[model samples]
Target: MTDGDEQVSGPAGGSGAQPADPPVTGLAAPNGGASPRRRGPLWTALALVLALLACGVPGVLLLGLVGDAAGRSAVGRKDDPATAAARRLGVRMTAQLDRQASALLGGDRTGFLAVAESAARPDLTRRYAALRALRVTVWRPVADGAPAAVDGRPGEWRLAVTVDYCFVAPDCTPSTVEIGTRWRLVGEEPRLVAVEESQAKPAGTRPWEVSDLAVAVGERTLVATTPALRAKLPRLLAQAEAAAKVADRYAVSGTPPDRYLVFYAGQAEWQRWYGGGRPKWTAGYAVGVGGGHHDVVLNAQSVSPSGMGELLRHELAHAASLPAEGYSDRSNWWLVEGLAEYAGADGQPVNRHEGLAEVRKLVRGGWDGRFDSLAPADDATDDRVGGAYGVGYLAVRHLVDRYGEQRVLDFFRAVVHEHRSLDDAADQVFGDPWPALHDECVDYLRAIAG
Candidate 1:
């Protein structure tokens, strides 16, 4: 929602209501003679007007003074010299940003670096190269607000900037992020001094911004990795493309993304980038970056080559099927994770068996036959969490088996995306009440576990 319309206020006098003329103090006599009371007030008014004219103040100036006193204006006030200067600075800085964006898109390194100060050129150059390597189709930097002058620094200012960019072509839905930038005006030109995270509006760093990337592009996937994993880029891309194809089969809600953007994070990066709150056992995650676009991040050092395919499939399924607004509640965690697990374990019987192993162990422990009981705690062990995922998968699988895959997907969309009650969605999609469906799913899970 960057570059939205600015809100504007109405003109000088609020409600555009004019002030009433001063009340007539007295009436003229019927003999065509003014009363003494009226003559006295009229002379007083005339004397005040004459006094203002004697001071060399024009009638318009008199009116303006009156308006000022009344907290209104006959005409709008002009911007002060300082305010006007800052506005001009913002305009110049915006033009400079436009040039920088154009330079990055056109692959003109020299032109891109030209807008930055000498001290900033090196970092700017690195950013330019990273973005160019990513092959972003859209790069627009817009001023989020007016520039503010830096205290004690002449001709220097700071501004909040929002950048919108996209990776895929033909359906380039841009993702927007905010940045804080500093600039110094040298004569009529503005040079960028620094770019940093906006304290006012922080956003997750893009993969290119995290480190130098070894990028491999495929027809339906783009895999980016650190130089440390450059040797593994091709294998990762092949797996990701394959996973994307599998993920596309579940796109009953809409078309799959044009290209699945994947970032393979090394050990150091896994701890630093993409908001960094994932559990240690978590393999990968998908982030909805706006406009139905998503980006996948993988723990490259943690997952094995054999396990990577399933992990990719799970996250990619999320990318393909997750609604723009995301799921409504954690109560639907089963459907959320289950759908991904079902997609990941598709056509892999051994994987399915391994996934349900923990569920079987829990059933032997006399656990309650409720999916709610399978919801993992925040600090749950990896095995327990895996069991929960397995239970979710079974729930989804049961629905698919009884009703069919498309119906299951539709029911999922109704509950998660449409924010409908599970019972309501079940009644609509399956012609059964929620309790009946819930009991059926629980029975199926226990039977599968046995």
Candidate 2:
């Protein structure tokens, strides 16, 4: 998927770990809760991950990352030389990760005591650091070449682990995790070569101060992370749920277990975890990893008239519809994004005054395909941050007036289907490829503004 160019992609701390055995907890970037081993510990690390999953904690990031099969082989045979040698090294790394993750998740306090007390030993003062939780999940493991770098010199390998973590509210937010660690040989056992904490506003340098963020509403997770932002989440989510409920009862039905609302401090923090930045919508987008099941990650930090509800409507639309289509420029860019903008804002357009002002802005800029078609809104500083969201935002407003809602949905359905381009799907929607109606859409938006 394309990076949301206008925004930011903070440094990804530790990324991509073993064949996922979802671990319990971990944190990073914002908080130094997890410093995944940058050195040796292949077999033992992954085995512990597998053990955690087998032990029944759903600790894994759902993004598909594979673990090393060769490493696992050592575990099955007790006498395997590779397994015997790496045990201490592996145990050290796993214990470290386990300590951090457990603390981060606010796991059983007694359990934390038991492990720490049992594991302490002589000579290693590094083992006595105060504990903090790191919410982590393994994607694919990488064998560090620290061992091979000096040509047989003493070395360590790393289990390149991808751990996705967020400030979790006990039961208010839907929890998901995929635990895995990457084992790449380094100079010794897992050692800290790098420790990156996302200090930006998007991800934050520390946990959000949202004590009242979580409130269970008829089985739905809702949170208000801080006093200032806290008041807004309820209204926003309430509106969204109201919309979804309408769809559920009258339009669609039944929400999935994974569906959740995560309230953060601001736009940038949300971006750190899930922002793809702003891509030229026309070229299409890539959602999480190789792009499947996930869509634009949403947070309440980004708001205005273009704030929360409308913002979510737009983003969530991309998510809901992506399953029906693949995010590629080869597909109908117009149908995918335009259709999403259309669907999301359907019953939820910005207030008429704000909406009209937005139309005025788009009309003045003139809908150049260059801006709206391929450039990301974040980069459109000349138009402020509105970018083409305003342009396409209004176009959606117009389509609902012209073709009826089902037709708009039909366009999305076609665009969503694999191997089909927006142009291919055009005939089904407007009875023309995008360029054919491009000018017409521009004119229609301008006329509405006038």
- Writing each residue's lDDT as its tens digit, candidate 2 over 1-450 gives 132211111010000000111122332221112223444444455455445545666633212212233244445565332333444444455444555455434544444343232223221112122112212222111222111111132242333343443222332222223222323333443443322232221222222221222232323323334444655655666755643432232121123323333334444444344332332221112132211222233334334434444444444444344441134342234344454454445555345423455446655755454323432332343332233444555565566677776666666556444445556766767786666565666777667667
lDDT (CA) per prediction: 0.65, 0.37
Q: How big is the RMSD of model 2?
A: 11.9
TM agreement with the true structure for every prediction: 0.79, 0.53
Ten contiguous residues with the weakest lDDT in model 2:
10-19
Residue by residue across 1-450, what tens digits does model 1's lDDT show? 011110000011000000011111111111111112233443344345445545666541211111112123213776433333444455567767877888888889999999889998877877877787788777767665556645466546678777777774734666666678898756456689988743221125666665788788898898988888899998888998899899998775778877788888888887766555455455676665555556777776667777777778877887787775454355666787778777877666533445667777766766676764555554556666666777788888888888998889899889867889988999999998989888888888888887
Worst 10 residues of 1 by lDDT: 8-17
Give lDDT for model 2.
Answer: 0.37
